[model samples]
Target: MYSEEQKMYFSKNLLDWYQTHKRDLPWRRSKNPYYIWISEVMLQQTRVDTVIPYFHRFIDQFPTVEALATAPEENVLKAWEGLGYYSRARNLQSAVREVHERYDGVVPASKEDISALKGVGPYTSGAILSIAYNKPEPAVDGNVMRVLSRYFLIEEDIMKPSTRTIMEKLARELILDGTASDFNQALMELGAMVCTPRSPHCLTCPVMAHCSAREAGMEEALPIKKKAKPPRPELRAVALIEGTGEHAGKWLIRQRPQEGLLARMWELPHVEWATTAWQSDEDNQEALRAALAEQEQIGIQPEDWFMDTEHIFSHIVWKMKVYRAKLGDANRPSTGEEWIPFHYRWVGPEDLQNYAFPNVFVRIMREWQEGNEA
Candidate 1:
């Protein structure tokens, strides 16, 4: 643990360094709690560079908590499209609504109140209170953990509860002259720029002389973490089923069930691939016909379809095959399915701009559109 004097010394040195070297990030320019909250939430498990554009776009779309609260969920999701982990978008909406309704459109000032908001955990709460409100609280994230472990030569696995307890105590002890806001930002900056995860620039670190891990030649090894679990494997067979003329301009799009991976998102019609043998083109067509009948319950003759692509995802590889067919007199929406009629002004490629599409669909659309343009 860091002594009171040592903490003060470290904070002062780090803060001085930060004032000179801190990155000119947009979030750092303002002390608004709402802005800080959005940046914190977006930065979770995402790179700083990646979060920059998203932050600007989100803030422009919803300048205030009330704006975010009133915005449709679909618009919010659309704005957050490329950024994965859709739950964050949903939780952000919930948090905005709560802030508007309960807090009179003001972000909560107290740590407890901020922490009570949806998806606002201890780290986020700490960041808001310290950076926005100037409260003397520690925002102990992975960056801070690395800096602390190396500074104090801590050996416990960072994943362990005991390590967190010790690190939090040390952070509190080291806050400089109650400049919690600057001190917190300074430490975070150091971790990001100097005391990085791999090959940290120790020679340039402000507190290198005091870092025990550096002195002991174990700077790279401190803050040990537990091994990660193996990724789950899954297989899916997606169909790029197309419709007949003017209808041919659009394709069938379906909303996924409101639970599990990619919940409440739109996707192409797909099914699990069953092991089967096809000896010829006739056999392949027959297999496609039977699978579509069983899954989509659209009984169709094999003669009316053309096959076309395949796509894949991490942990879930897809063997996608496209089939083009015109909506014959027999082809219509069965129970539980919606047919975007051809005459209803097809959702033109440009109109798709406002909808939140999964990355896979986005890629497919890009390739398809490019092909047509070419």
Candidate 2:
């Protein structure tokens, strides 16, 4: 338990340090709740450097709440291409639409009103309320938890939900009147820069003088978190079907099913194998051919092998082997049989603008483009 004097010193010193050393982030420049919300969502489990370009482009494209609400979902997805975690984009748009319609394009400032939004959770609600509205709310995230645990020497497992509640209350107590915005951001900044996960530069940390973990020489081990289960790897075989005849300059692609993982995104045709350690390339290719023919009614004759790659999600990993192929079935829309009926399309490089893809697909396409250029 931290004393009143210690908490006050932590809050005052942190805010003062932040005022002098805070990074000049674009979202920090304005008090717009919408921009702040978008940035915070994008920042989760993502790096600051990676979010910078995406943030700039997203704000420029949408510009306002109404702009985002009115824009087509496809357009929004295209803008978010390669920024994995497609659900974030979908839920954000859904929530933004609510704000536009229900709140009259104004972000609700009250905790009850903002917290009720579609994707706004405790952390997000607190962040938006404090940073955007300057409310005395605490925005406790992984970074905040780490800093708090070290400063107060809290050894509770942060992975547990109850631990978050305790941290939130402690964080709220540390905020000075009218300084919640700077104070929260300061705590976040300190964790990111100095009180880092590994080899934390405690000497440069703003609240180091009163940091309990530092006093006990346990700064590196204060915030204890349980290890997560390893990702389950799935073996996948992909058909890099190239178009021929009038469709010579294009390649075959398919849109994923609408309600599952990586939903509503464009990707190459592939089939998941039953096991990670499959028999052989020949067996895998034959299985892919049979699966596509039976499942999609699309025929293909896989020829040579292409490059191999892998993509990782939170709980699953895809280890993929790409193969070159040409469409053997003339079931395409242009070839007679009805294709409205078809979820696949032959797309050229120029047509990539019309669709969004996961980062793995983007990497595959980039590699293909480079190969062609070379």
Task: Give the clashing residue pairs of candidate 1, or none.
Answer: 244-326
| Over 4 Å off, model 1 | 273-330, 333-346
- For residues 1-374, write the lDDT of model 1, one tens digit per residue: 35666566688899889989999999999999999999998998889999999999999999999999999888998898878778888998899899999999999988778888999887888898999988888899999999998988888899988888888878877776568899888888898999999999999999988888999999988778896554444344444455555555565566666778777777655555565332354555566666766756554444432333444434454555444333333455556354443322234467677667777776665666676679
TM-score, predicted candidate 2 vs. hidden true structure? 0.97
Give the C-alpha miss distance for residue 222 in model 2, angstroms. 2.1
- Per residue, candidate 2 scores C-alpha lDDT tens digits across 238-321 of 998887787786788999998999888899999998775866778778899999888888888888788899999999999999
lDDT of each: 0.76, 0.89
What 10-residue stretch in candidate 1 is worst by lDDT? Answer: 338-347
